[model samples]
Target: MTQERISLFVDHIGPFDAQKIGVLRGKANSGLELLNGHNIEVVQGFACEFDRLERFGFSPGAKIGSDFGDLDMALVQITRSKVETKLLVAQAWDATRVGGRIVVDGQKTDGIESIYKALRKLGIEPDTLVKSHGRIFWFERDETRPFADWLEPKLKMPDGFATAPGVFSAEKLDKGSLALIAALPPLAGHGADIGAGWGFLSRAALGHEKVTKLDLIEAEIAALDAARVNIIDERANFEWADVTKTSGRFYDFIIANPPFHTERTANTDLGVAFLTTAARNLKPKGQFYCVANRHLPYEVVLNELFRNVAEIGGTSAFKVFQAAQPRRL
Candidate 1:
């Protein structure tokens, strides 16, 4: 029996994902090592894929890629979020030769099944289907063809706040963020709005006279880009990063209304990871504050992670927690 050809793989493919340090590293390592044995060259991200290869530990030495060479097979895996799967299908249809295969893996909760059905609309329904935690759909892709942008119509908007479709609270004023802005102490010194979706907390953070710098860290590309327009001052810094896995110099004050749920799952508290990571990014004795829903047990997460945790304020629907890192020994 002959050995099966190893396929090009990416742990994820999404715009604005600041997930450089997650399962992606393992996928990159395996994919790159296998590619070295074959004559195949892999292109990961369409425009900026090469720049990230070595930037995050994906590939040791890969430059940004602009074009696609001949590809025999491609595999992409996404977690609990659905992306424009048709876009991937369209890109594969155009780039792959007639006999090439394009495999997509994503969780059922993330709408992976819908993406599989969408393939039929493009005349590329799966020839292979495997189901488990999610579904794996693979199909033969016909040579390259023009495709529509599925995300084009989902525009997000609010007066004075920048937002994009699918981003958290992009449609209206977020209650917790509004409450934090109101409850915030006469904030002073350099600060940041971790996970600054659509520049809501960022704008409020920068508006304070005490804040000399407002570093906005957001993972979503569209949301991060939206943040840039609202924050035009010299003190503004816009970075794309998964706040949970982000690293940087310390700030005097940090504020957020961290995410507590996704895909119908409640109290996931991945925000706890953010709280810990944000603690490291703050100067010793730096202040930390955020708003969350009423029922979530974030206090346990905070108490276990931070030196101190206190409920500064709450309403019927939401509550705010103020925390601080201990002075280093």
Candidate 2:
């Protein structure tokens, strides 16, 4: 008789990459605590969350961006939404070697049961354990599951920009961004798009004949990858970086649609950091333009960092601010 192959405990995990194990977009590092002292590689694409993990001393054996590459086994903590979870699961399936395992965990509200059912449809069955308002499951490597389709590569957005799953405004051009673009004053010389997702704003910034070069700075690797394909202009530059830590440079102008939230919680600090960094990275006489939700408390920080701040244009749901003359602090 064949033996059943499922275990409820983390210790039950089968042989895996001795040299390296991967944690995919791990926010809390829940299951990882049990693997302490083992070689753990963390793959996270969001810059702000990565910064927090670094500050907390998660101390991964190695750090990587979006691509998990090849690994013996991967533990993926499910993201809050279905699309995000599907993307991560697809990545894990692609990254793990044959005979390797993919372990997944998430709260009930995060749709763990649905994900489990989906995996079953791929011709692979998962061993599941439900506890602590969440569920944990594991599945061995199987060749039959065609996960490539789950990747949804090079999806075209409504604005004709190339974007992918898990990136901001992936479905269409952001309406606030369009309004901000319309309100943009004449820009010149080298400029940048802070939090540039898939180069939508960067592409628009180039419309100004005086703007010779534009940099698209984004933290997410997937978005940057799409941006590479969308913005083919010789003058467009790309950088995958955390905006908060980048400074000591100067640009003629900077534009942003700074992210206002991390996870489910609203964080105005994220927007404020973008403003501060915008000030720090701009020439004394340079200009900053950004859009945000109408209620976000970013004006105080913008006023503190710039000699002049004004509401240039906005909708009832969003507000666009322009700041100039970075104040040396």
Candidate 3:
């Protein structure tokens, strides 16, 4: 559905005469080929999308840095967060050259209509085309940068953690993670926190006096950046990696609050993949601690992968598990 919307928008406005084009928040299958003959630069933060784009021979970046400010055209892909979508639009405007075109595309479910209305409210009327249950709007950048202020709002949590608009649990510590932290036993030696968002779980894990080192593995660059800021301890090692994929290192212990959704709908397969990776990356005697929603069917996989699995603790909304002695594949 996201690919179809991007293709429809690209097909609607093609054969561009621009020399350079910028795509913000693009995914792996974002139909980037439609602009084949142009010098394209993608701004994608998610590690999965960034790795996929790199594998496909595109030089994609994780952030819209200051060096990417002279594009002849810029495209903004709307995300689930309205504030993040608006921030991408502001970035598109900032990256495009004066008099250059800035295009925004998103599904109706992603609040495309709201963005259109908000743009109009800012005194900038954009030419729009509606199709594929989405909208593609474009406007030329002018000398007056009305969206400048939109880029200045940074979300700082009450605990002084710096999070961005689109990062998971940006506003506060996730309840499931909190539950996992509460249930965590004193960890020691080299351990890993899979899908560690903003370093909350890793920070909690590091509270144990015996814990020598904790790797905070996160897939989102934005969240990893926050983790870098939130966790300043020398014992915390940060890694930008997809938790679903296998890593070479074996850990003494592993903790996770695996994400269950990649899109609007819940995907149990993602959590399953995380479990698979955890099993694969654990030492034979390593322990794995995880927390998930109570309704999620993680117990079966946990039992299949570990010799012993038990519900350590949790509330009605979440469940914390402890699994030891991973089965060798």
Candidate 4:
């Protein structure tokens, strides 16, 4: 659905004649080919989408602090979070030169209507195109820079743990992860925390006295940046990666609070992929620990991958699993 909306917007806008274009929060299949003849710079934070764009021959990079400024045009893809959507649009405005075009696209479900109204409230009416249950709006940057205040909005940290808008469990510690942390046993040797959002589980895991080294693997760069601030130990290593597709190292044990959603929809396949990665990367006698919503059918894959699987602990709404003796494929 999002891909179709992006394609429609790109087609409606036609080819770009700008010298340089900036894309913020763009997905791998964001119909970027429509602007192929133009010099384009893409800012995508998610590792999976970033890798996909790279594999498809796009030079996608992370949007570090205030980069990609003075572009001829900027494209903004709105995310599910209203705050994040605003931030992306603010970034688009910041990157584009005065009088340059700033185009924004988003699904209705992602609060595009509210954002459109907000722009009107700021006294700048955009050229709007509504299609495919979504809207694509464009406006020329002006000297007023009405959205400049949103460019670097301050974020509050819950429980003093650094987090950003749009990251999972950003406002508070996740109950499922807390349950898994309580279930974890005394640790030793090297281990990994897959999908280690904001380093909550990794911080707890590092408390184990016998643990020698720990790796924090996450797909989202914003979350990883938060984790870096949250976990400042020599034993901890951070990697921005999609664990399911690329886990180059094996571990003595693996812990995860795997994500099961892509946007607003639940995707059990994502959890299954995390389980598969855990099994494939674990040492011969390694253990895998994870927590998930009680209704997700992860046990089937856990049983298939490991010789022993048991429910260690969890609340009624969540389940914590401990699997050992991974079967080598």
Instruction: Point to the candidate with the largest lDDT.
Output: 4
Clashing residue pairs for model 1: 16-220, 16-221, 93-144, 94-144, 94-145, 189-210
254 Cα displacement, candidate 3 (Å): 0.5
Tens digits of lDDT, candidate 4, 1-329: 55676577677777756998998887777677767788989989999899888988898887644668888999888889887889888878877899899988888998999999989999989988888888888999887778876777667677899998889998877899999998988988999999987899999999998889999999999999999999989999999988897555678999999999988899998999999999999988899999999999999999999999999999999999999998876
lDDT of 3 by residue, 138-246 (tens): 9999888798878876665847777878888888778898898889888999999999878888888888989999988888988899899888899998888877775
Error of 1 at 243 (Å): 3.2
User: How many clashing residue pairs, candidate 2?
Assistant: 0
Per-residue alpha-carbon lDDT of candidate 2 for residues 1-329, written as tens digits (9 for 90 to 100): 00011124544655434555677876533545555565667767766567666765675322345555567778787776677788788888887888777878777776878888887887777887777767788877766657777776455576667887768888877888988987898889999998898888888888888999998989887788889998888999898888778887899999999988776678888888888899989988899999988888888888899989999999888889999999888
lDDT per model, in order? 0.62, 0.78, 0.87, 0.88
**Candidate 4, poorest ten consecutive residues by summed lDDT:** 1-10
TM-score of each: 0.70, 0.84, 0.96, 0.95
Query: For candidate 1, lDDT tens digit of each residue in 234-321?
Result: 9888876667777667789889888876547765557777777667778887899889888877888777767888889878899988
Model 1 scores worst on lDDT over the 10 consecutive residues at 17-26
Candidate 1 Cα misplacement greater than 4 A, ranges: 1-57, 60-65, 68-70, 94-99, 143-146, 149-153, 160-167, 170-173, 220-222, 242-248, 261-269, 283-285, 301-309, 324-329
Best by TM-score: 3
Which portions of model 2 miss their true places by more than 4 Å? Answer: 1-8, 11-20, 26-33, 36-39, 48-71, 108-111, 121-124, 146-148, 153-156
lDDT (C-alpha) at residue 59 in model 1 = 45
Give the better candidate number (2 or 4) by lDDT.
Answer: 4
